[model samples]
Target chain A: MVRGMAFDTSRRQVVKGFACLGIGATLPLCCGGTWIQAVAAESFTLTEIVDGVHVFTGANELMNEANHGAICNLGIVIGDDAVAVIDSGGSIVEAGAFLAAIRGITDKPIRYLVNTHMHPDHIFGNAVFRDAGATLIGHRNLPRALAARGEFYLRSYRNQIGATLMKGVEIIAPTMLITDRQELDLGGRKIELRAWKPAHTDNDLTVFDPATQTLFAGDLVFLEHLPTLDGSLLGWLGQMDELAAIKAAHVVPGHGTAPASWPQALQPQRHYFEALARDLRKAIEDGTPLAEAVGTAASSARSDWQLFDEYNERNATAAYAELEWE
Target chain B: MKAVRQDRRPMAGTASKMAAALALAACICAMPSLAYSQAANAPSEKIWNELKTDVFEDRTIQSDTGLIRIEAPKRAQDAALVPVDIFIDPAKFPGGIKSLTLIVDVNPSPVAATFQFGENSGVTHLSTRLRVDDYSYLRAIAETANGELHMAQTYVKASGGCSAPAVKNQDEANRTMGQMKLRQFAEQDSQTGKGRELQLMIRHPNNSGLQKDPLTQYFIPPHFIHKLSVSQDDRPILSMEGGISISEDPNFRFDYTPDGNGEIRVEAVDTDGKVFRDQWPLEAAGL
Candidate 1:
């Protein structure tokens, strides 16, 4: 039998540490003069993509298996009066850490918490900000997405990890809903929120920071890695072109490192989707079996992109089926 | 003996004649019933027999001394593709190992992948993105210092991972492949410089065979990363073997002895032969 006893000490330490962190109590030893240093050490490091707008990359610390995409970049838009958080992150603890990071940088209250989509990793932390009085904002489909999967996420979190971290995490519904587009002013700073239909999800909202010429293009653009498909591939490809037309100086992807040019950042995703859609269409026309179509289409894309080898066939297959149905 | 002798006598002859008649009557009586049962129970019996054979089979796994360590979820929230990690203990196999194999008994194809490590490659660790066909035993057999296979097995609850969607977005997900991110969790306590954890995230679609392409009305093909390597300062620390059980955007954590300095590098090779590499510089905190 495999020895389970060897991991006990480490497991105990994790449980104890989690218990302390879960209650939000400062560790006693670190609470003295050393505590100040710890807090200073814990300060959220912000890398400025442009003046006034910052990307709060979560501490490269915390080995989270979830939220792998934006593990580093949590795009923060600081307005003159208040700050708007683009994605809330994976959990209440993470959101709390994010809020603390925000507090360290500026005293401005979080005026709005805009959700890019309904993915749990992006929206699970909504309750933390909502409890802190930030107005939750999202697309019209947000509520439905949350309602469908929120309980599942909660159960998974509690069952897989532990309940302490997710305790009291209420799924807060977005108070402000946008169907197509909406504009908001944060103390004279104009922020445009647009609902991109059936792209990444049923409804994906992108926040444009006009002053900084930065667009928080949620999952619309994943820099470097493979994109996960939830919505229509064709729709996403078209949206990418539209996003390229926006002419933003910087694009903060829902995941990956921030890109200096919005168009360049979105190109990889565009090429992938276009190629997938094109190949799938041809396969459907040729009457290629679904399995063969996936293999053939993915193999073709494999030579150009490294990540494609992992997901291309699957993407093609899914795109083919979705398109076939449509 | 007396009973046998008596039964064998003429008294038994009359009994035998009656027995023959009875036997004929019994065959006549049972033939239709036997045919009816065969027709009724064959399909159910086949399923039962398969289950019975699988349950009774002796599945024994042997491990090479230090070549591989299998890490499975203590409890998996989603049964479909439970995240699994395989690490090669460098100290145990100093000559630097080659080739890692994963055999998941419940899966349709038990042999997930066989990886050939590169030269001078601290390619001791691999993490793939995989699929688990069912709740069954999983084995990792590593060829070690002496060219013998060392094995380890862990029981994983199987969910229908093959059909899970690659992600919510087909296009955006396609763009993110080969992009790698490394995150270091909070430092250990100052008193104990032990117990450091690093999380590595790789972007991939991790397509399992079960998802229906909404457009084509067909099953998406299964493609996933079969191997991963995590190294520190050019030294091997963890190697992973992955299958369909690995979720999309596969993320994993590795615990290691801290030198308190050196860059941690992660390189992943997917089933389709795409390679991605990323590195993170270690920060020296007193802890």
Candidate 2:
């Protein structure tokens, strides 16, 4: 019922904006893209990328809108008999909302919850699935990842978000740990879980759905958004090559809109990484200080990406430090 | 010091006769008080009363000259893990204190860690990482000279250290474990040339039990370094037992009197039983 109200309000706002824009149609279009060209105006909220595969492009405000930097797009993939949720949001509340969305689609129980990496924003919602009797799955390094920072997260969540909302949130380790690749069939739907090594994170898992010809690429691919490289710049760039090789019809990134093709979405991140690696290597060879390298590296890549002004410098600094010894 | 004495006088009256003995029993039987009375007032009060009975009741902690000294952040920017430094006065307990214990009264596990230092250890100065559940007073108790416990305390603001993810990738972080670096800050001038401050950086995940896997939609298991040993010229100087409060890739600074030319060795053991060791060469400098 509340959803209907929200949709009605949003429709009215869209109509009002269109009415005002019609009066300014005579003015030379100041914006680069047409109203039709703007992806935000397309009204693509949550949609099924394929059969039983739903992707919620979290509200832009909920995503890369503020201090909470963009890392990955959260996703949910439901199989025939049971649902396999991918990349739980940053908090239990967010995860609960995602679970509710899943319930709205089907009555299938969430049997498997897979984490692509150990970043806090992606995994802080594990407790919600564990409470619902879903078996958590991730790479072998995930247990160590959570164990290292679990208590601290619980305390922080209680302090920042309030303990009541986070009640019964348990930091449960993944029951199933994948080493290289693991394949599971949820009824007739085949899901392939592949652990890509030393990319994005120490252990990054990419879920490929054969039935839908769709690949749920975690942080490995960022479409129309800045990519955060917590792993080696060189390693992530190499992984991008492997991801591009995957012939999937649709690619769901950890963040941003669903990619129509792998090359379009994955190539930019690879290019950014390549650019970062090249600059960092040159700086190291020249014995340039880290601070100086940051400016030179970011300025070089500024024109290539959209959110370069926001994260390029930091990315350059991280890339420099990461590749310095290598 | 005098105020601590005055505060005990009223307790003495409550323990004078039959009522005193009963009160003493209640105090000993009850639990130590929970530190945060501001947030969870009712429950924390209950927990505090329970703790007051279970621990810290009728217990007299002597503040000797230098038995135990606790150093912690006056205001922490992050609450998950806070660095805590403990120094035992050499004069007060000459036989090299046996064990040191930390009690963060409000944390989920109040007894953070207990370390048993060897006899060869000189002027015990141990630093460890810990998780502070809230803004609370942290107590460091040392077993000393007369086989009695001496304690010192300092208040630390709330920090979310545990929830904070390790900055680097898991593999990159793994490759750098056991790598130790010592940075010496500018020393202050003193006539005797006694104290020198040095910052030590040790790379370890120090995972607290609160973070989740980004893609899996599940919680990551908790694993953290539990013990640290520092030695100079192959001789033990300090050893620390850690808890969830230790920050990831712990950076700690301590003041010490260096002995001429010696190499410092540091060994750390994580809760997952992973051990790492590194060495740093000591350089002589004026304080």
Candidate 3:
């Protein structure tokens, strides 16, 4: 008990520093200046994807505090009158850097903050935007998903990345929900938001910009990174087919480089899903149990994707459960 | 952090080698200590005999292989909710099954559940989820109508599931705690007959009195479903006496023959003496 003083002290600091800069859960005068500087000094770089559409592509690394919780793709879309930020980074410091990045580019007031899904890396930085008075937007099922999974994700991530980096990691839920499809005008520019059937997650919302012919296809479209199946494998396979018909020129996926063509960028992920389905069918046909099916299903596609070893087995387990009845 | 890591690497490498050498010395010195621990850890054969006698008092135990088969994952991905399938061949048991009992030997409360088949019921198969706290031997004892008892046992490897974080926050879990949902698996409610599979999802934190609440840092109270009973219309189907080994939001899928498309009802009592009930329509739920 006495030996864990450092960890316990840090945990206390983390709980104390939970809310965003000077806003929610304000700290006392003692460590105020140092804490604010520590938060403000965290740096992040962004790439201008297109005219008025800037994106901060995350490092192709796992969750770690050194990256200041910027481990997912985040972007800002500047409309005529207001600015809309998409997918805030993973922590409070990242959220501060995100706000700074927006300030560096433009002084437009942020009106909307859109979250792609319920993943913590994409949603934990919501407090910064909320403090900026941006109305939060997410899929209809996002609230329930947050309710069902929010606390667990928070605690587990704190354990994984340590509490200091997770200080500002609070669940800032969506105020507005996208059911099927809705069109939002960020002034003159129109971005179409579509919430699909339980594909990437039970609540997966994608943002499409008609001006640049660009689709911010959240985790629905994966590039070099492996596709993760947290929702239905059958549903994801079907959703891919629906996404293919939507013609767009540029696709800014949730991870990796922006795809040159819209739905065509989904080819690798489509192949991964197809491989998973085909092998799972054979496993089910042969009465292969879940343990064996995990190893054999989609084993051939291991070399083609990143983090395949980390997720393939789990994906196979889900696929086996679904395909056994089929 | 980087400086600390860099400074420690060489020391760690040397420490491991020195530790290996010291381990050889320590093993010789700690022989008696190790033997004493082994004796303390191993449960006596008398305790095993006593537990069996306590659970199956005065009942004759016969070894009849292949009559009942228990299927569970060798390595559970989620220890909190490990799916266990029990299949008893009705053809092998011409006497018909009278009751079925599930037990996870290592759990604080070993008797996970008990199912009593209604009259004219030919239930040879059933499945349910369990929260296994540690690596343990699980048993499924089936009692035939003729008073013969047969048991099937398997060892499962799993850990940390009982204390893993609950799916939702404390407030949400408390508010939704006693809510239940029922659905038919293989057979739809409209065309239910014999050999139809049905699933029952019960909403309960099923706190094992082990996991600490994040905010309070105290063990959530040991309030869990202690007993559950299911009936179709007026006729009884099955009953269970659950334990801490039952997962949060305890769920079950089993074969039950429907008696003319009747509404299925379920009644459960928790450890705190709170009774919860829910029912499915004559038609399937959410139909």
Candidate 4:
């Protein structure tokens, strides 16, 4: 059921109607041309890392009105005939801007819109791609994850990022599911998609461009941004070796700078995970309550990462719940 | 009472809790409901005011009585799993508390869980995780053997907890459902003879029933551990009537005086009528 190719004419027309309504005054001069892309590229720049691959590194900040919820890395791969997108960004505004940026690069029909996980920061712009006739692709478990958390994300993020930006946002589940591994061909170029065990998230999927030796390690290999765990701690720590084993010359992490050197970029997160686990294990062994232990569980790694104060205790809380079962 | 097995239906207390949940659900569906209006203020006095009558039914509740204390994060990192600690001082009521009720006032089902303590169980402190749906009061109401209620509460600033969805690994969660484990801790030297601590972990989804299936356009029915009883040497220690507010993979850690010999037993029942039982030989009291 790859609904992405269905091309819902009515919805696209409605979306077009809304877009025109936003900038109706200037439509006569630049209505159907590259006006949108020209405007989009003015604010959002997609840096070309390799030959045809471009990366847009978002701000290292939480999703707020100021950032427009563009807090995750987004990628675009241009091929001979079609193009492939890594993520949709965090809002309709972000996604629209991203699609315009892609249009700025190439008019190739976006053959696939790949979601790395179920986090809103990565997939909120899906509706825009769905309108662009790009087939949505994700992990097999992604639909279930989206179904479960989609409403909550919509409701909660409205408060975090404000309602004006949340308008027209829809939680669109992927139709093409990658159970284990799948190679998507954008005309002549082939990109690999691999779904991993529950690590940073249960439905984590990574994209690798073989031609460029670049891996889009979605939230799996965070650098500067503190990794938030919505999945199993033990599962994540257990699979670090396997994740690091992926032979990628450069990596585009979900929340960090683009083109990070592979395997080496994993060190900081690995250290943070080990520190948090060590502290939590000691606390559990010592009979210290979760409420008391999480206050200082990963304090050793606090100064190393950004947003440590905002997410460390929360990560410690999640880790404590998972580790206590071990 | 060794190896006692009771197939209990929803008891009166459980039924009222369900009623409270249904009433709260109705209140939420009604336009401009209390749940929505209370979100602006952290310590929503209106929600607690309405929830008190629904849960306790006009009973006099004494707050800040020094008998019980509830601790929770001021702003939860993860709304789906907020750690809550409830400590009870036995000296305040030497007769012992008959039961304790946990309530998250702004949650869809405010009566999170109610536990009935066994006679001489020596249980004084209870710690568990809850899904706080909004910025609301997390309350622990302890009923003395004489039926007097003493309350302690803290305001937790969190939202979207009850409807935060089930575990991320849904397949693994289902596969491991109903599995139980109990970890025993050596007696603390400071609280000698007060009893050792035990952490009981059970694998259950404990879904809040608020998540809607996008394909079906209806809520996935709530599935959770509704009845749980833990005992030592077949003597009752504590039992609980729980609801969806309990986190996935329900866990409870508490201090209990273990009998010198025999095994510790646990039996839990979910909404689907699945029964799971496990027991472990009690270790030496101090070793």
Q: What share of the true interface contacts does each candidate keep?
A: 0.09, 0.31, 0.01, 0.47
Candidates, DockQ: 0.04, 0.15, 0.05, 0.43
User: Per-residue alpha-carbon lDDT of model 2 for A56-98, expressed as tens digits?
Assistant: 5643222221212123456666666777888776655445555
Judge candidate 3 at residue B39 and give its lDDT.
Answer: 31
Better of 2 and 3 by lDDT: 3
Clash pairs for candidate 4: none
Q: Write the per-residue lDDT of candidate 3 for residues B1-287, one digit (tens) a residue.
A: 00010111123454444434433433342333223222323332333354577689978866546788898877664455567888988778877788888877654445677778888655767777676644566788988888888888887764221123233223334666776766564454454343766667676767655333333443334556667888988788877764556766777767776778787788876765566777766554321
True contacts kept of 4: 0.47
Scored against the true structure, residue B251 in model 4 reaches a CA lDDT of 86
For residues A149-218, write the lDDT of model 1, one tens digit per residue. Answer: 3443554444433454454455666889999889887776778999986776766899887776778888
lDDT of each: 0.57, 0.59, 0.66, 0.77
What docking grade does candidate 2 earn? incorrect
The list of candidate 4 runs beyond 4 A from truth reads A1-42, B1-43, B159-165, B190-194, B214-216
Best by DockQ: 4
Q: For candidate 4, give the lDDT.
A: 0.77
Q: What is the lDDT of residue B61 in candidate 3?
A: 65
Rank all candidate structures by their TM-score, best first, as comma-separated numbers: 4, 3, 2, 1
- What's the distance in Å from true for residue A286, model 3? 2.5
Question: lDDT at B217 for candidate 3?
Answer: 40
How do these models rank on DockQ, best leading?
A: 4, 2, 3, 1
Best by TM-score: 4
lDDT for residue A110 in candidate 4, whole number 0-100: 88
